[model samples]
Target: MGVHTTNGIQGVSVSDDARNASARRGKKGLLIGSGVGVVALAAAAYVGACYHYKDAIPEGTTVAGKSIGGMTSEQATRQVLTLKHPNASTKANVTAGDQSFDLAPASAWKPDAEKTLDGVTEFSLSPGRLLDQINGGGEKIEPVYSVDKTALTTLVKKAAESKIDGAPKQGRVKFIGGKVSIVDGAPGHGVDEKKVADAIASGWPKKTDYTTELVEKNSDASDNAVQAFAEGDAKKAMSAPLEVSANGQSVTLTPAQVSDVISSTTGSDGKPAIKVDTEALLTTVLSRGDKMRVPAVDAKVVWKDGQPSVVEGRSGKEIDESKVAKIVGDALVGDHKATLAMKEQKPAVMAKDVNVEALPSTSMAHFESPFPTGPSQQARIHNITTAINRLNGIVVQPGEQFSLLRALGYEFTKESGYVEAGTLQGGLHLDGMGGGVSQVSTTMYNTAFFAGVQLDEHTAHAVYISRYPMGREATIWNPGIDNKWTNDTGKPILIKAHVESNKVVMDFYGTKKYDVATRTSGKYNIQSPKHRTVKNVKGCENTVGGGVPGFDVDVYRELKSGSTTVRTEKIHTKYKPDDIITCQN
Candidate 1:
């Protein structure tokens, strides 16, 4: 009976332990199911949050201190564009020298709206950004901006121009009152434009006010250095007066004059040095030389037995400039006086060098015009003689052109030795300078016509003058009317002009290569002179001009080389009527 009772107790105990273990396992399973349900609900909440703001800016995002969180891209762009800056419109005073310029930072810098919006939208779709927003962390987006560089640069330059002076000038030697002295250089102010521009570009976007300072520049050369180098030399150069002798004449330079030629300059070593300006010193020496110099006379050609004769030329004496310069330099350096050397200057055309072989021996053309013989026409004759002498020894090379105006230098004023005489004006004879030069022109034209040369330009007289050829003549007025001819003779030509008691003759000497023959279509288209009255004003003289009939003519020139015609040219001319000009008050 005891054993059976023990067994039943053991079985009851075991059954009781199994029922407790199953109850514990059932409670654990129910807890795990509840935990899974809670995890699923949290995941669904996270996914819904991400989907809700997928196309929108995440929360807790700000740009330029403006909260743009949870806003659309367009909304954020508007916010960025309308963001107000307190100092954006503020004007800053930029001063240069004595000038001040006003600069507006707001007008120079502007915010970029699209760039700001892009930043906001890009961050909204970022996985890390979404996680951060969900975790309650916020992001600060930087605002992008655009700056007008040109406008900013212009503003800086204007400020610089107003406040800054030009660069400092170096010290130099200046001559004043026959003395040598140093002119000092000054330091200058320069603007650091790049620095100012960079500052504006950096702070302007932030709406900050700033002031830029200009840079200071110092001059490397000044009065101290110049004076130290030149003072001793200047004093030594002027210690004693300089005596210069040239061409047997002597002149003394004053102490001040000696200082005038002593100049100060910087050497290759970049230090001031003293120098003697030979050119400047020569001015004084040349003055004495001029007084003692004898001018060389060139050999002249005169017609002897209808042929050219060479007149003897004389040599002249002048100071040797190079030797004199060396002497002057020595005097300035050590000596007190200089005896200048002289040299003999030979004429360009020597009498011994000129002969018939060196000259054009054959006479190619000759023309002469008679002048009125009276005391009243003395001035006119003298004028003609002056012009002829000027044109006496002109030699034209082969294929060279000749111009009468250029030969005479085209100066027809009283200073040029032209005397007042009767000149043709408005078909009347009037007293004017260079009046009788036309006589020389007419003679030269006829000579050229017979020389078989090419005549380039010529104008006939308004009124026919009996002194000249019937259809072959030319007249000249200063600067406007000219007579030109080219030597087509393939050889050199020499012009010889002479003035006689009543006639001026012009002759061309060259190798005769062609036989020139001329034919004229006799004067036609004759028109009678018109009688007209004149109402004179101030500076008018009472005069009556004789009338002459107008006519037209054509001249043909034929060139023959050994009886074979080479070329022929036609020269046509028209003369206007000589109207009766009455000048009256």
Candidate 2:
């Protein structure tokens, strides 16, 4: 068809194949463009979803058994607080070989949110991440936990050592059927710390119980070497009793004592060694030994501004219990006797050893004696005060006697801060050295009596003084007489005496063992006083106070521990009548 000539006749005719081909091309183009648009929209939606969950904790992520998946920083932090913290009682039981140990890690499974969330993100351009974000989460995060590294490491190492690093039993000295014998040693395996640690880490914070195997360790000292030393040491240690002295005190270690604590063990140098239990050794020595102990000063309560506060006291030279192992150990292996060097004397009463809270208060056992009045009043007060000052701060050790004479160190005379006061001699009133000290002696005796101590040496006065308790009073002379007592309480006794408001106050501070109660029988065998004339004897005071009937009496002491009486003892006293005296010129 010619377009120009057919224009007047309404165009030329086209081919049907061309028209159909043109329509097909248009339809194909539209379909192709629509497919491209759908793909582009899907990509945009994927990118937006990825950005939505940016840096979020992966869904299904759990920390220390807590679900914190898909949580934001703030939400995760708040959820971390709700995680059930590991309790102190939570323990991990582990077994290695035949020995089992418990691991009580202090909050070892504690969740660490900051560490878990640090640089964590589930959003990513990668296909896998995109798919994961769309489906919630793809990663299950391993919980980050914190622990006491030092403590956990030490515990792990200890478990390892105890499980496998056991040395061959060197042998133990034991008494068998009344004869000394050695308990044979046994072989043990060595340890592998790295192995044990690796095994423990595999299940920590997740596993509560574990089992491991130990490898063998090489020992320089064979089991035979240890047993050999043990045999020889046992023979020597059990031969005889060892009289050991430390800080002026003596304790005899019998074969039984030696056999109880002495044992052979493998040394770090791979040599066989003898080890002694210092605590058991000292306890035996102190309990079974003779009376050679001195008072150990301990902490006590003091009144400051009328308020009670614990005041710590200094310790004296005493047997060093820590070093006693070596001292007695050497003697067990070498000599049969030992006089410990002075350096071995340590403070028996350590700061930690003092029990000020349980101090035997004066309220528990208190004694107060009034000052004797008259011409000798001032002089007697002086004598009593002097005696009390000397008595103060003197501690009576268990198994040792507290002798006033020894504690005074010298006879109380006019030159030794004492004066002539009213004293009873030959049933007459006279001035003598250390006269009023009898009041002090009585006060101290009462303290010991009510405080539940052993009354070793005490004598009643000649006359029955109304002021002092009848039959309970004691009299102390210058050089001969002394009030003595022993601390049978198994604890140190501290004497704190002072003259307060005309009264001699004596208090014994120690650990309270039991409550003491006394019952005195009525006076019997009464003796009438005599009438006597003092023919101007020098220093004889004209019968200041006299004329009292004397008699025999008995006192019963009941020691009770929480309403149960442990033991009771009776004390008897015989007093001579006080004679009525008339002065003559």
Instruction: Candidate 1: list runs displaced more than 4 Å.
Output: 1-357, 537-546
Model 1, span 1-585: residue lDDT tens: 123347456433345567788789889988998899899998777667766656466565666644556455654664566544436657655555554455665555667878766644542345676675455355777776677776776676555555455644557666444566677866666556667777777766454445556567544445676777557555455667888877677789887776677666555454665556666666655544434455455565667677777777677776676776557756765777878777886654456545555787678998889989798898888889999997897666543457787566565767678988888776666787888899999999999999887677888888888688767889987655789886655455788889976999989998765689999899999998887666654333443455778898888889887779877878887888877666666
RMSD of each: 37.3, 26.7
Q: Report the number of the highest-lDDT candidate.
A: 1
lDDT of all the models against the reference? 0.69, 0.65
- Model 1, TM vs. native: 0.41
Q: What is the lDDT of candidate 1?
A: 0.69
- C-alpha lDDT (0 to 100) for residue 27 of candidate 2: 96
